[model samples]
Target chain A: MKFLGVIIVCLTGGLLLYGTTDFPDWGDPSSPASTHLSDYYIEKTIEDTKVPNIVTSVLADYRGFDTMFETAVIFTAGLACFILLRDFRGKKERFYRHKPTGVVLHVKDGKKTLTVGKEFEHMDKDWVPSDLIIKTVCRILIPFIQIYAMYVVAHGDFSPGGGFQGGVIFGSSLILLAISYDLKTLVNRIKEKVLGIFAALGVLIFVGIAAICMPMGGNFLDYTALAPLVWDPHHVRALGMLGVEIGVGFAVMAVMAIIYINIVSEGRHDEGL
Target chain B: MHWPIDLIVLTFVIFCAIAAISVKDLLGTAILFGAYSFMMCLLWAVMGAVDVAFTEASVGAGVSTVFFVAAVFRTSRRTKD
Candidate 1:
């Protein structure tokens, strides 16, 4: 059976490589894609949307409907992860550590809970003393990483990064915090409810901006219709794109956090890596 | 110049892909998958698709690797097959 599977995989891979042989050469000027809308987008993206980055303008302005659905798809993925993995049942065993002397306490009862104070802290089953170097370095670096992420999101019109990339970077910073410390540190800082709300809010911001355009005498996602709302009407499209990018950034960041938290904790919202 | 760099990255990508699948240790596979993603990101950058390269670096190489590690932490490290 294994040999048959390997043969099938090899055949499929060969067929795929063979299929690529018939395609246009890389960056062929007269290829179908280059001859068609590529020219228009390259030439007129700046004039049309006031965004210098053609990719940003094309993604958020010219083909915004597609991007909107992409945000919805991300939101749906987070929702699906939440629905499938979230475990509401309490864990039967809980561990707490006394901060002063590092005395570990284990409670076996599922119903009874302890009131954690300064002396007592929640501990994971695989808890080890968090390294001072890792914690200190991450503490110092997280701010810069977060700042760079915001820059990527804000400067998408003039640069390579947009909301998705920026959001992922920001989410990874949060994940880094979890890795350096523990999952409890992250969960305590950002609540599960807050993450869910932000995820939904991000998608709402995108749809809301798009929907507002329709009532303002333009088609869906028409930034030109948003001219009246902003102070500088000439750069309204750029501003609109920025707004949409921010919305995407929020959604992606929250969803990344939600998925990480859920998976690491196995829906219990407690001790994890 | 570009072709040589591209060729090197593509070779690494293929190598990582094969190694990741064949590795019996799931932890090793997760790290190899990350190496595969980083190589793919380099290939995308070489092709002048900077935006795609950025996405691949952050989403593919950065966060997804952490996700895989977290998953491995929760489950068994050894694969049955």
Candidate 2:
């Protein structure tokens, strides 16, 4: 199987290298990619959408339907991971270890509840002691990381980052918390059901904004038609773009967290690696 | 052509890619792959695609690496290769 994989990869690389021979010189302004709608997007994005970042303006405004679908794709990934993983059936037996005496006790049938005292603590079968340095540093840094993620999402119009990047960063922060502390710490902070709702809400927001434009008597994602509702016709596209980015951010964040949690837990949230 | 920096980074990228695949330890491979991603991100930044570079830095070097590490943690560390 590995040999076959190597052969396939080599073939694909060869094919790609052969295809690259017909490509224009690097950074050529006359290249098809730069000569096509990219030129128009560069020249007119600021004026058309009142957005300084041409990429965001083009992605969320000019080609909004595609962005909406992209958001849906992220949401679908989160949903798929949730469906594939997330075993809710409680474990038949729960185990506790006495820290002081080094004695292990197993509770059968979830009938008896063990009091989590200073000496007694609930433990997974294969549990590693948390690292002090990692836990401490991450505890201090996660909030700042999350704030930066939000800033990236909000300032996509003026910055290089957009919803997708920002959302991934945000989701990564949650994953970091899980890594530093444990999956229980993460699950306690943000429930699985809440993440599911967030994933769906993001796609709904994108679709809702596009659907709103339809009733306004314009095309599906026409922000110009939103002129009557908002104060300025020129700035409405920028606002619409921001809204779409926020939706994308939410979906991507939820999906990334979902994938991480499921994969780490191996479909059983009872314990995480 | 300002080839020095680009060539150096590209060389490192290829080296890391090969090293990652050749490594027997899956966790080590993941870290090397992350280094390769960082190099790719730098190349993109040099090409003036700040947005693509940013995405690669955050997603490729950051989240994907974490995911890879988490996956390795769940499974065995040793590989036949």
Candidate 3:
């Protein structure tokens, strides 16, 4: 059976390779894809949206519906992960450590809870003492990483990065905190409820901005309709794209954190890597 | 000039893909998958898709690798097949 599967895979691969032979060369000027709308986008993106980055304008403005749905899809993914993996039931066992003495305590009873003061710190079941250097370095570096992420999101109009990339970077910074410190640090710092709210709020922001256009005498996601609201009407479309990018950034960041937390903790929301 | 770099990156990508699948340790597989993603990101950059390259680098190489590691940390390290 394995041999048959391998043979089938080989045949499929071969067929795919053969099919690629008829494809246009890379960056062919007259290719169907390039010839269709690429010229118009390249030529008029700046004039239309006032965003220097053609990709940003095209993604957040010209093709607004696609991106709106894409954000919704990411939100749905987080929602699904929450529904499938989130475990509300309390765990029977818990562990805590005396911060000064380095003594560990195990509590078998589920109902009894500790006061959790500065003297005692939560510990994972398979916990090891996190290295001081790593923690210190991450502590110092996380802010810069976060700032860079914000820069990427804010400067999407002029740069290569946009919301998705920036959001992922920001989310990874949070995950780095979890890995360096512990899952509890992350969960305690940013509550699960807050994460869920941010995820929904991000999608809402995108939809709200788009929907607002309808009542303002323009089509959905039409930035021109929002001209009256902003101080600089000439760059209203750029501002709209910026708002949309921020929404996507929020959604992606929250979803990344959500998925990471859920998977690491196995939905217990207590102890994890 | 660009074709050589693209070809080299593509070759590395294919190697990484095959190695990731064939590796017995799931942790190793995750790392290899990250290598594959980085190579693909490089290829995208070479092809003049800076935006795509940025997405690939962050989502594929940066975060996804960490996700894979978290998953492996929770689950078994070795694969059955």
Candidate 3 residues A84-187, lDDT tens each?
99999999988989989999999999898788998987788998889999999999999999999999999999999998999999999999999899998999
lDDT for each residue of candidate 3 in B1-81, tens digit (9 for 90 to 100): 777887888999999999999999999999999999999999999989999999999999999999899899988899987
Off by over 4 Å in 1: none
Q: To one decimal, what is the Cα RMSD in angstroms of model 2 from the true structure?
A: 2.3
Best by DockQ: 3
Residue A165 displacement in candidate 1 (angstroms): 0.7
What TM-score does structure 3 among the candidates reach?
0.98
Residue A57, model 1: Cα distance from true site in angstroms:
0.6
* Higher-TM-score candidate of 2 and 3: 3
Structural similarity to truth (TM-score) of each candidate: 0.98, 0.92, 0.98
Q: Given the true complex, what DockQ would model 3 score? A: 0.91
Q: Estimate, for each residue in B1-81, the C-alpha lDDT of model 2 and write its tens digit.
A: 767999999999999999998999999999999999999999999899999999999999998898898889888998965
lDDT of 2 by residue, A136-244 (tens): 9999999999999999999999989999999999999998898888887887799888888888888988888888988898899998777888877669988888888
Task: Find the candidate with the highest lDDT and give its number.
Answer: 3
lDDT values, one for every candidate:
0.93, 0.88, 0.94
DockQ of all candidate complexes: 0.89, 0.84, 0.91
- Model 2: docking quality category: high
